[model samples]
Target chain A: MDFIRQVLDRVGDKWSLLVIAALEAGPLRYTDLQRHVPGISQRMLTLTVRQLQQDGLVTRTAYAEVPPRVEYALTSLGRSLHHIVTSLITWVADHHGQIREHRAHTATRP
Target chain B: MDFIRQVLDRVGDKWSLLVIAALEAGPLRYTDLQRHVPGISQRMLTLTVRQLQQDGLVTRTAYAEVPPRVEYALTSLGRSLHHIVTSLITWVADHHGQIREHRAHTATRP
Candidate 1:
């Protein structure tokens, strides 16, 4: 149950899911992840990536160089998560407009 | 893209996913959703449910009965979400242990 809770929490988190989703195309550097996921702050990006790394869903690699370089990528585990989240995304796109109109009509009634 | 972001945000939220996951069994009242999801406060539950309802992921029904009665359930939309979330849960359970140990081992060495 705890495991389910954490997974739900991780997947449920705004930053983490977008981070995972962002990496679907391929590996990205820290800057790339930030740019790819809009509305994400530097702090949130760092925190979420660390959380993902700890969860073993993301792997971070650092390159020893003059300018300093770091990259983040999905492990196989992360890639698998994409399939799950993608399905949810597809479901939402399929249904959200109707749901919104229903709520709008219901709210105006009283 | 906004739809994807909102859907991601909704799913990424802690309370909403659990609330949706809990409802997989059947419909429940507001209080019932609270009980099913441990650690959820009434505020978050109400908020998350409203968000889900707005997103068309959850359907709320009110009965004109003495003392007032209401029940919430997944629209076909919500049920479709169950399929998506279940796959995520499965992925977590399948991999969490190994991931935890990997983090632990790496943590101590560096």
Candidate 2:
């Protein structure tokens, strides 16, 4: 439970979800992931990717190229989460109206 | 994207996940939710539930009674997320070994 709770805390962050989803397409360098996930800072992406790597959701690879090329991609576990992550976004888009109404209903109840 | 992103940020927290899971059994009052989720502060639960209520993941109903009885239960959308949340937990439990190994492998590579 502790381990799982830790991961939920790690990935449930908005940046982590978007960052992982951004990499689902294929390997991305740090810069690429930064660009793909709009509004993420270099600092935040570095931190989130490091955390995801610790949690085993992302893999960071360093190439032996002269300029020190590096790339990030989803591990199998990370890719597996694509469905749920995407589902979450899909659910939100589809139900924004219902969600809004639900909130409004609750706000007035008190 | 904006709305969904906001919710993931709201709920990806450890407290929110556990609180929602705690309420899966049935309606819980504010106190009930707090007790069920260990390590939660009184103030955090109040804030989290208010957010969950705003996002429609939780519904709070108050009975017109002497003590101001209130109960919270998962909305339909909230119930739908049980599988996903449970999946996240199950994934962690099932994969803790793999996850640890993956992290170890990455950490030493640098």
Candidate 3:
């Protein structure tokens, strides 16, 4: 249970989910990922990617080229997580309005 | 997008997920919830419940009995979130070993 909680803690964070989702289509260079996931600062994107790689959810590869190229891709574990998080993102998108209405109603209660 | 992120931030925390899962069968009192979710400090349970109530995910009802009774149950929105989070929990449980192995492999690398 503790292990499960730890995994959830890693994957459930906002930036991590966004970064993982951005890499769902395929491997991406750092700049590509930054562009794909709007509103993520470069520092946050860096930290999120490093964390994901450490947790074994993402793979980072660096090329031996002139300018140097690094790409991030989801491992199989990451793909599984992506499937689960996509459902969550979809649920939030679908019900956010209702949740907002409930919050409004709750706030007005004295 | 920001709104969705905020909602995820509320529900994605460890204690909140545990509390919500504990309420899945039915409404539970504070003590009952504490017992249902092992290792949860009273302070964390209180905070999680309050946040859930504020977000309109969990509903809290207080009774004017001799000792005063309060019960928490999932609202429709909470139920929706529970459905999504359950999938995540299941995925984590299923793949935790693989993830552990990956972490071990990564650690041994230079």
Q: After superposing the true interface residues, what Cα RMSD does each candidate give?
A: 2.7, 2.3, 1.5
Q: What is the DockQ of each candidate?
A: 0.56, 0.56, 0.73
The residue-level lDDT of candidate 3 at A3 comes to: 81
True contacts kept of 3: 0.77
For residues B8-99, what per-residue lDDT tens digits would candidate 1 score against the true structure?
A: 67665767777878899999988888899888878888888888877678888999999899999988877877877767666766877776
- Chain A only: list TM-scores of all candidates: 0.87, 0.83, 0.92
Q: What's the chain B TM-score of candidate 1?
A: 0.85
Candidate topping lDDT? 3
Lowest summed lDDT over 10 consecutive residues: which window, candidate 2 chain B?
Answer: B84-93
For candidate 1, write residues A1-110 as lDDT tens digits: 66656667776676787788789998899988899988888998998998888877899999999798999999987787887766666666676676668668768766
- Give the per-residue lDDT of model 2 (tens digit) for A62-105: 99999999999998988877777766555556777777787778
Predicted candidate 2 versus true structure: per-residue lDDT over B52-76, tens digit per residue: 8887888889999997999999988
Full-model lDDT, candidate 3: 0.84
lDDT by residue (A1-110, candidate 3, tens digit) is 78878887878887887788888899999999999888889999988998888888999999999899999999988997897777777777787788788788878989
Clashes of 3: 0
For model 2, the local distance difference test gives 0.78
Ranking of predictions according to TM-score: 3, 2, 1
Which segments of candidate 2 are over 4 A away from where they belong? A101-110, B65-68, B100-110
